[model samples]
Target chain A: MVPVEYYVGLSAILFTIGTLGVLTRRNAIIIFMSIELMLNSANLLFVAFARTFEALSGQIFVFFVMTVAAAEVAVGLALIVAVFRTKDTINIDEVSSLRG
Target chain B: MAPVNLNDLLTILPAVFIVVWACVLLLVDAFAGALGKRLTPWLTALGLVVALVLDVSAAGVQASAFNGMLEVDGFSHAINVLVLGAGLLSFFVSYDYLNRQGIAKGEYYILMLFSISGMMLMGAAADLIVVFLAVELLSIPLYILAAFAQPEPKSEEAGLKYFLLGAFAGGFLLYGVALVYGATASTRLSEIVAAVAAGLENPIFLLLGAALILIGLGFKVAAVPFHMWTPDVYEGAPSSVTAFMAVGAKVGGFAALLRVFIVAFPSLGVDLAPVLTGVVAATLIVGNVAAIAQRNIKRLLAYSSISHAGFILMAIVPYADDAVHRDTAAAALFYLLAFALTSFGAWAVVMTLERAEGKGLELSDYAGLFRKYPALALAMLVFMLSFAGVPPTLGFAGKFFLFRAVLEGGYVGLAVLGVLTSLVSAYYYLRVVVIMFMEEGKPQAAGSPLLNLTTGLTALGTVGLFFFSQPLLDWATNALLRLF
Candidate 1:
């Protein structure tokens, strides 16, 4: 019986924190983790909204988002490993072989 | 539950066929060893051709299928053909480049097919969830392919940067979708439109959601402010992959942009139009001006592609104007087709000339190219001219229609800026031509029949399309008519 506005506000805070982490993090792995946090924040919003409205569609969308997040992690971690192998570092600032 | 039917299955036949074939090819390549790598590109091309044929045959059957989650109509079919055509051309160019670069893995072709199928789905998606899934499906493969040449540090960096930015954009898109669903209580485009029409929700939520969605798509299409990843990604990724990303991603992004905005957010034109107009102007100014300082050919073309996105976005700026809706949509579609062909040709030439470890990308590397390979040089000339919107090319025809559409919609300032920026574009585009024919130095021309074929065909299409543009214009207009 919790109010929907409180859930929405919590999600907004979580989303803002995730965005900041992504923007300020220097490590590629941390940035990837930050992105996951952002997606999960959206998942929280979707679940709360779905519960409030009694709609199955929002929950279904959450499943898709989770699947997509997993797939992204698989690819993103592999890319991080590749970058590490080549550059011997995971810091994004040092991985700057391609600049304008 | 709605009854499942054969028609619904048939509606997604092209994408289904591609996905199945790609999976099969992945397994075959895994087990078959070297032979699979040799045959994968051809097999991938064959699958795309079949999908294209299937798409055309079913083009006239306009129907919403899968409980209205997907729409099989002229608009989707037209965009499918362009996306598939870009895939086919990229395959032709990739075969020899992969062999020369010694990265001819089967996974490359499989990933490409997956990406192409995802793009096709984006064109057909009628629900926001489907759109989100399609975008992820298309993008995930590209992130891997960007780093396909793993031992190379730059390629890995390109992949990492693209993945980070792309995932960030995906988060924005997801939040936007959730907000829209929260406001309207439905994710279906038609249902959402009805909700907006009925005025059941807070306008602020809808407006914020739409802006976020636009930001996400703008990143995919490489519009200004969101375009930082494009130059580095294009310049560092293998040229063939860059070609695919440049055309395929733009087509998918614009397809979703048009469908979502025109269908779901038409009621918010007063709020959205100024925002879109500002994005278009910034994209035009930044994309063109930045290219002038680029010495690397790949980076230069990257900026050019961004500028081209600006022009296409201009066509969509007037989508809410009832009088020019059809014309605007048609012009946008035609411009995508023209840009794809021209970009494929330009990148084909670039791929042919590109050396190991990404050397030979300098503008001076193209010096005296005409003397070594006149046909290749001439093809590059046609592509550059097309990029500059010179007359007697498909680019000119596409730009003419687009400018007229904006003018009809009473955006004279945008139309004028479009023309002026295109003039600025001419300097960089012609600089390549001037270097190719007029300058005197021996530029090494690697002989590859497949690359030559791709270049020759795209050049012919770029010029030939102008003379035979009537049918395409009619097709574009007819395609837009189906949506309404």
Candidate 2:
């Protein structure tokens, strides 16, 4: 069996990459996907930890995280559509009418 | 085995009622059509009142529900009062503002009720999973609500920015929860505390988890460094939603932050205090100094809101200190009440003066307001003073209590910084007051009875509540949290 440390390191790396994508990407859809990646990294950690401890609670929380992440995506995509409707673009650079 | 019993439902009756009422309002909107637009606000107000009734009637009762997932105690009770009162007041202000904006839909009020339900859950949530869910439950509605003025570029942009940042923050919060669960092998606060007492298997993970959780929550409360989205979002969202979001959202975030940190990680006080100190300091400096340069009134108020979040954060800075957490919680609650009243009044005045197409949003728009409308201008003056924490207002009393809590928590330097920022804030807060009364221009305020009444009542509350402040503080003091 593989060590849990590997899973932890892998998830951390995934989380960092996701964060970088969110910070660097200009497209709203890409940012949305980056958030999904970050959330899934968290899910991987939860499952790995659950297996390590022989506990179902961590796995249960993963289910909650997945369900809520899905809900957030629904609302987030709707917001992206709203932005597109108003500005005719989904680029974060273009959605800057209210900036300081 | 899951702890499924009637007692669990009974303990969370008020929150459950709020969700039930929201779902019912959705159905009401579906069938009632145009009539629902006119009817929903009243029904929403009625639902909040009933929840308030349920909250009050359930007073002096304490219980843990869902096998320690929900904690109903004095602290949660006080939070219920604050959140519901904010919901009711926001409803009063929103009805006219939405109608004026020509976006008066039934779903608006329904969405608010659902968000308010999430807030209520945050105050009472005792498990990590519940906190994660509560944060999303509160936020998802707001992400939609911020963009409620769809096809308005500013509103959609605000919505999208808020969604992206809020979702980014949620990832951190969930990971934090996961780390905490991994360390303690439980998501429940009671068990987590027990695990901490027995000694954490991995203390580094616990510390990292707390810091990440703080980042996630700090975003919601509009703390500095995490506050990049505040001005844009506040400027773009409809004025009424901004009013509600300002007071309603962070109170839940702070509530959950206080509960989780105070209960689960009090043992990590040495590590947490310095971090909180840095956040409080930066939030104060940035929030105050930045407000001085704002040209738009909405952005000005957004910075003011950020600074107030800093002042409230002072109460949480010394969270790891024994027994002081309770005092700090009370102090924060009182400050939140003061903020809600003052901002509700201020925003009502803003909404009254606001013309369609965002015409009256500039700082210059308030010129000669006292000459045209004395009462409204005077109310604005009162609100500005309260926000500046000046004398003869609820804000003064709030600042006094919160500062004392900080001093008690032994954060002397942070307390000094808080005072200095309040001084800096007075300049901008008073600048508006000056423009309203002393300057010269033709200013017309759209006078509506409901908004006028809201402004009048909140101004009175901001001033009058100051004299009777001790009793309010005592009430908050009496609200003992049902945790270690």
Candidate 3:
């Protein structure tokens, strides 16, 4: 029975948290978690809009986004594991070899 | 609700064929024995060759298929051919490189085909949702391929970095789509255009959506601010994947960008012009200037690619402020082809120089390359010169048309800046040539002859195209005529 604004507010909070984490966290894993949060925030917004507009297309899009996010998460975690094993650090600052 | 006819089937045939071929490869890999791992790349290459032929045959027959989610204009047709050609060549060079590196498998080609399918779809997409899906489709596989060398720490890092940034870009793009849909009550490009045409003046939502969409694509194209991931990921990924990325992925990104902006956001030109100008200007200056400091050849090309994105962004200007300038779009398409061929040739040479042990090729390592590998050195020289936009080469010809388009569109200052940046970029590109021709090879340089058949043939094709570029230009102009 909650209005649409509540969902919007929740997603906004999630998205802000993600942004803060991406900016502040130095650990690669935490940064990745922040990315997940960002994606989930969008997913939640999509569902809210789908409910508001009574459109199946928005929900369908959410499904596709979730699928891609899962694929990305699996592959991303695997990569972090590999990099950590090689360099012995999950800190984002330590992975500076690829940076400018 | 109606049954399909030959026309309907013909329209979707190219995408369907690629999808079927990809699925076939996937199944064969899962079920077939050693042959799947060993022989599927050749099979996949053959399938792409066939699909390219079919796609070319379907050109110039404009039709909407799959409920108008897909479009097959001459422009999309041209991009499809280029993408498929790039994929086939990637397959060709990959076979040798993968065999040498011990990562040869059916899955690699399967993922490549799937990625290409996404690209083709994106190029033909007329809807915002379709565009979003297509970007993800094109990108997800690339992330995996970037790290396909699971044992290599650099490869893993490349994959993770690309994934994080790509997903972030996707979120921006999706949010834009949602806002656009909220404003226009439709995700279809045609519907949005109609609504705008019908006097919808909600500039706030439109401008915000358009800017977000541009940011997302800017990331994909490696334009200035969003291009932070390019050098690192390009350096860390395998050379072949990097080569494929520097060509195929770029064509897809620009093709989608051109379509969306020209078709959807053309009405917003009054607001978009200044913002886009700033982006193009900064991208040109930053890409060229930063490239000068890179010691790694891969990172240099990455920065060069960002600069190329600036040049491509110039094509968006006239259309963003004016009508669909077919000449400018045509010129941009030609530049895309020229850039693809030249950059692929350059990266293929880089791949050839990298030994099986995965040792990176530093810029200084090319010292005395001319004496040791004369043909490769010459081929590499052609690619580097072409990229630097030197005379009579396709790169020069491409830039000539691109700047001419901008001039015709009345962006003379931007065109001049583009030329000036090209002059600055010549320094680093020619540095590779200097190290090859002017310097002496270090004594540790081995005599391993670098006559990689697939990559060498690709280089020859590229170098020869520079001589025969006029016909291609004519063809590109003809393909672009449809957009007008």
Model 3 regions more than 4 Å off: A1-13, A47-54, B1-10, B321-324, B356-360, B442-451, B454-456
**Predictions: Cα RMSD each:** 1.0, 1.1, 2.6
The count of backbone overlaps in candidate 2 is 0
* TM-score head-to-head 2 vs 3, winner: 2
Q: What is the lDDT of residue B346 in candidate 1?
A: 95
Candidate 3 clashes between residue pairs 3 or more apart in a chain or in different chains: none
Q: Can you give the DockQ of every candidate in the order shown?
A: 0.88, 0.84, 0.54
lDDT of 2 by residue, A2-99 (tens): 99999989999999999999999999999999999999998999999999999887888888889999899889988887778767899998777776
Ranked by lDDT, the better of candidates 2 and 3 is 2
TM-score of each: 0.99, 0.98, 0.93
Clashing pairs in 1: none
Candidate 3's displacement at residue B252, Å, is 1.0
lDDT of 2 by residue, B174-259 (tens): 88887887788888888888998888778888888888889999999999899999999999899999999999998898899889
- Cα distance off (Å), candidate 3, residue B112: 1.0
Interface RMSD of each: 0.7, 0.9, 2.0
lDDT values for all models: 0.91, 0.90, 0.82
Please name the candidate that would achieve the greatest lDDT relative to the true structure. 1
